[model samples]
Target: MNLYAIFAIYFLMWVISAFIMLPFGIRTPDETGEVLLKGQADSAPSNFRPGLVMLRATILATILFGLYYANYVQGWVTLDMLPGYSAAQ
Candidate 1:
């Protein structure tokens, strides 16, 4: 629940999320013929790929950061303690 831990988790999650989404943006699109419909996104593998990638990456980063931040402030999730140390049975 400390600020240090929160910051660490946020930073770690952000970097990881950004890196993961980076690949989706870096992939080049093909010139294959496809049917286009109205109101559909035109994400061709062109110069605009990187920008779209960045946008997605940022959104993913936000989500990751939020999850990490929440987890950081959450209660205990482990119970590894043992019981019954008596000698007589």
Candidate 2:
């Protein structure tokens, strides 16, 4: 793949990873028995950590991107393997 395509794929992976990681380590004030702020929503996480989430997302994205690149190089899967896909269309 070209450099730009690689970057784009990596960025897409990172975004998906970040979103997937967002809810894993979260804890609401009620869940942790902490006092909620005056204006804080009940569902808002009291112990949200962006740095940790970003770190986890980066690691996961890197691994996923590596696998994706390997698949691209190895041709482990192709469009024909997917149902309803036809190149003749």
Q: Which residue runs does candidate 2 get wrong by more than 4 Å?
A: none
Which residue runs does candidate 1 get wrong by more than 4 Å? 1-9, 25-48, 76-89
- Give per-residue lDDT, candidate 1, residue 42: 64
Model 2, residue 50: distance off in Å is 0.5
Candidate 1 versus truth, CA RMSD in Å, comes to 9.8
What does candidate 1's lDDT look like per residue over 6-86, in tens digits?
Answer: 678666766776678765633233444555456545664443465666677668877877765565457333233225444
Report the error of model 2 at residue 46, Å. Answer: 0.9
Across 1-89, the per-residue lDDT of candidate 2 in tens digits comes to 89999999999999999999999979898889999878889999988899999999999999999999999999998888889997778
Alpha-carbon RMSD, each predicted model? 9.8, 1.1
TM-score of 2: 0.92
| lDDT (Cα, 0-100) at 71 in candidate 1 | 53
Top-TM-score structure, candidate number: 2
Which 10-residue window in model 1 sums to the lowest lDDT? 75-84
